[model samples]
Target chain A: MNTSSNDKQITDDLMPQKFSKSGMIWVGILSTICVIGAYAYYRQLRYGLGVTSMRDYVSWGIYISNFVFFVAISLVGSLITAIFRLANVAWSTPLTRIAEIIAVSAITFASLIIIVDMGRPERLYNLFAHGRLQSPIAWDVIVITTYLFISLFLLYVPLLPDLKIMNQQKNKNSAWQNKIYIFLGSFWKGNSEQVKISDKIINILCIMIIPVAFCIHTVTSWLFATTYRPGWDSTNFGAYFISGAFLVGAGGVIVAMYVFRKHYHLEKYITELHFEKMGRIAVMLSLIYLYFNINEYLVPAFKMKKSEAAHLAELFTGEFSIMFWFAIMVGMIIPIFIMLFKKGRKPLPMFITGIMIVVGAWFKRYLIVTPTLLHPFLPMQNVPDNYKHYFPSWEEWAITMGSLAGALLIVTFFVRIFPIIPIHETITEQNEKDHSK
Target chain B: MKKIIQNRYLLLFFVFSSMLFANRSFAQEDAGQEIVKLHYYNSNNSIQYLILESTLKKNKVFTPQKDKTYQIYLDSAGTNLIAKVKTDAAGKGKAFLPPTLKKIWDASPQHTFIVKAGDEEIISDFIITKAKITIDTLNLDGIKSIVATVFKFENNTWTPAKDVEMKVGIQRHGGVLSAGDEETYTTDSTGSVTAEFKKLNLPGNQKGDITLVAKVEENEFFGNLAAQKSVKWGVPTKVDTHFFEQRTLWTTRFKTPYWLLFMAYSIIIGVWGTLIYLVRQVIKIKKLGS
Candidate 1:
């Protein structure tokens, strides 16, 4: 296994490194975005929902869709870490921390963005007080909270050993970084007892997280499906949502892998093989999602009932037509086509494809919520003229962008603090690879 | 001497004949007695009239009572007047009597009556029978026209009237068409009164009861619409009977079983809980297998 030289390299290469010029620029950009988002949220609170173009008709706009998007992207963590680990897929070991960080950050913002979608944010307590157990929103609260805790636990358990390692290795970075490491991980004595227990607990939590992840996304889809809306009234909604979630989550991993590999020079850890494998998973999920799309659209199209006709027509040929088809082609079909090829599954091509899928899926969530609401049972009538249309205001855009940036910042900070690749798992895998050779 | 003799003889003869005739007439009349010419009229409509006669005397005191208050029973049912009355100053006064219950043997049945000083209270051991007034025809130009076959108990059958004669008074069609409109136009036997509109511009739906009312010679006719003892021809127009029926039905339906709501909630929650559990179990096994 070339233990001596490999150990030297691992110790040197895997240590928490300083942010370079580009890394600083990226952090600054993300921080600026988060700040803008905070200010925008303040404006929204003051002016009421009136600050947003969303009226009573389109009660949920971009923030809710983006929230769903973030949650969807977050599931990649469980898919890569727990699902692959249980499946004995050794290639995904190095990518586990990377995926888990993304999941944690994305789920965190998903929760936040949901609060932003609320009209009576102050009366958020009513959710607990007056919560009708039958309401999908109540179910969402229950399951999402469960998912968040499990995901957080999953992220934290794996980071304990890494935290101890960081604390032991002295660095030139400021005292604050050292303090953060001490505060977060000082309790870890690195005893075999702690390590064994931590590993067992992490395994249990990772296994628990798979179903919880499925529930969070599935229930989120139910939030739309439980409604009488034409577009959302499908039994295939849970599968549809889960498949699309895996696609976006995988796309997120691809993009994150590319970014971290380039910025950190961790090509040895996050290799082309990871990108290729992730790209294949992304493509497979995209196709599965596209198949559900056919079921979601085609069966309804066959009959085109009185209520569904207008909604379907709007997606097919009306104002939403462009966005609808664009999301399908760019998000699912194009990414599927790109990932089908070996060269396209390379890091650079996969990153571009991942970006397309993420962007497309965002629009797709928007498509899921808006078009159905616009075409209600009764014609949109007796409302203000502007109520007929829904274009998110600047505040909505800012909060949405901020939430995205916040998720990124979560991943970025997580990577900054601990090894983005699992240092222990990667070294172990590298030893195995060397032994196999 | 001759004049005194004539006066004594005539006085003796008059006293003897009056004594003998009184007993014979009283015995004969008592054998088959019936209340004849029993009819009612309300000159000033403040008082309502209910009639039941006793064959015991020419004048019977009557007491009136309401059959029911507004609740408990459906129609003024089970209510009765316990008081009695005699005839009035002109041998007639009003009594607000409870409606008759014809089911009982009428040997000494209680009937409400009222009277003034000269009126006598009478009770008879004879059966009281229902009586009705009948009219042959009704016609009101441009509004209503009917050959009204009214029934009366005469010759032991409820025979329709062969002939009818009366004057009907029509009120002026006020701008708002209703019984509230006030004026008078009389119609004699030639053309009897039905509900007919004088002006076509009047609201077609405007209606009121056409009461066959008689005038009392001595009493003043006050403008009390309720005072008229109306022999209602068809039906009263002022009352919305159906509206009250609908209101009653609505109130009764709203008292539905409360348990239905709880059952619905329980079913919904139970189904959702089961679905969550099933999905959770499936995902758990799938994760373990993976």
Candidate 2:
């Protein structure tokens, strides 16, 4: 296994391989979760939204928060792949496909989870039919649809040349791989003119995706901000959401980097340098996000308008205090501290920190949506006592976890088919490095 | 020659002017009780009448109701015709339409019959008293301000209408006002004008009575012109009071509810989402430059 293997041999080795024994078990577990989630969704549909622990008082719960988390994580596609390419940062070439696939899968479920949150998903056509221009839900529908198409295109256009490579060099791919490659990119000739057109199109789409990426999360923030509830009624919501989204997205990419590197034996490609750089970026994002959190929570707590005081106190020390403090410490503060050390920026520590940030961010979103609803300006009264408390029903948990597993399964299958690293981009960067030497 | 022409024109104008003045005087003299003035008085003393003109017919009975007790006979049917009246108390059961000696036949030539007290034979012939009762316009003007007047005919005398009932009222048809003899006005001539009118108080559906009457000399004939005059009166009917009461009821029927605020909030959320979507699309397209 010479590290400086010839280009043909390298391409052959790097092409996607079949699942190993653990890979099969992992797929089985994800598939099982997805099936259970689908069954839970069937029960939810049969029993109405009432099947979840949501009610009139806590009208929105884990489903909406999960949707926000998925959308936030999906932003990594733009950051790791598009932003790095536009800046001509060459080291990220190996991780670009992993980020894009993660983005595509997460956003697809982000859209699905939102539909799951809907009371009448059967009338999803109402989004187009009676869709009012003035409504924020309609806006989310329009932008989410646009973002999905753009993300799919972004992932597809770059993979065309690779697909052609796998198709022409059939010795490396199985019968199924050869079929997928031919079905996807048989028309790609890899001529200079086609290459030039593809490059120009990819560049245009990458630049276009940035603002859409920003807008998807910003509008998602406005869903809470526009409400009259004390905790959600903040002008700081949009920027706060955007900053948190970037932090979580960077964390997701780090997690993917470690897992893909260890499992696929791509340690040579995804090296310590990639981890250290991403670790530093993640730490900086966590700090920036911490700044936004302070602005979002502290400034309001200082004023403590009579309407807001009770809600603020509840998060600080009341029933919700545990979750509130937990999300802040784990999601922002701990990650910042962990990644601050030089040794902590290594692959294993960074992976652990990434997992902490991701989990903390999920609960943070839940705290954002659920607590505000519970603390509406009018006191909660006369409703069933159960309405005052929120704990996701098993059905809700199943559906939410299934969506999460579904997103991972898509990433899993994507890696199975396409080379998780962009072979052409990495070879080009490698050639440039050799020439420079 | 011009002065002579002017003098001839002036002479012709003087002749025409003198004839017009003579005609106007003649018209006023002919206009008698046919153009008598009417005023609503609070008491019988206030109802002083200067005799306009009078005409009385012989053996005529002016029975306002099915029961009557007086009768009269006229000597002639023109101005200055004299008439004599008798009462059932005096064993005479007829009355005259106009019972004055100064005028007789010049009054309308219609005869009214007084039925006897024991006249159990119900008369089939009904006389034309009023026709085509049409409500031109029922105005609620002066509804709050109107001092409702009711009247009753007394022994050989008539009292003018007076306010007796104070309660809810409509201006025209019928309403409740003050009721009792104490609320009535007394004339300086020692005439007691006791009136009773129904007082309407609430908003809708009035069911009460207000009867108005002009008192005639009770079964007695009087030659004095002042004694012959009847006091005029008006009272609130049940129908008029109902109209204004119904108006107040509708004013209280229009008040709004609490769920509308939440619906408005949802509409605002829909609008906010739309704007964010549009702004993002515009920015994306600009970045694409396509």
Q: What DockQ, on C-alphas, does every prediction get?
A: 0.01, 0.01
Calculate each model's fnat, 2 decimals: 0.00, 0.00
Error (Å) of candidate 1 at residue B185 is 20
For model 2, residues A147-225, the per-residue Cα lDDT tens digits are 7877887888888778777887888678887887877777677776667667776787787788778888888988888
What C-alpha lDDT values do all the predictions have?
Answer: 0.68, 0.68
Name the TM-score of candidate 2: 0.62
Q: Second chain only: TM-score per model?
A: 0.26, 0.21
Considering the two chains of model 1, state its CAPRI-style docking category.
incorrect
lDDT of 2 at A66: 95
Q: How does model 2 fare in lDDT?
A: 0.68
TM-score: which candidate is best? Answer: 2
Off by over 4 Å in 1: A433-437, B1-290
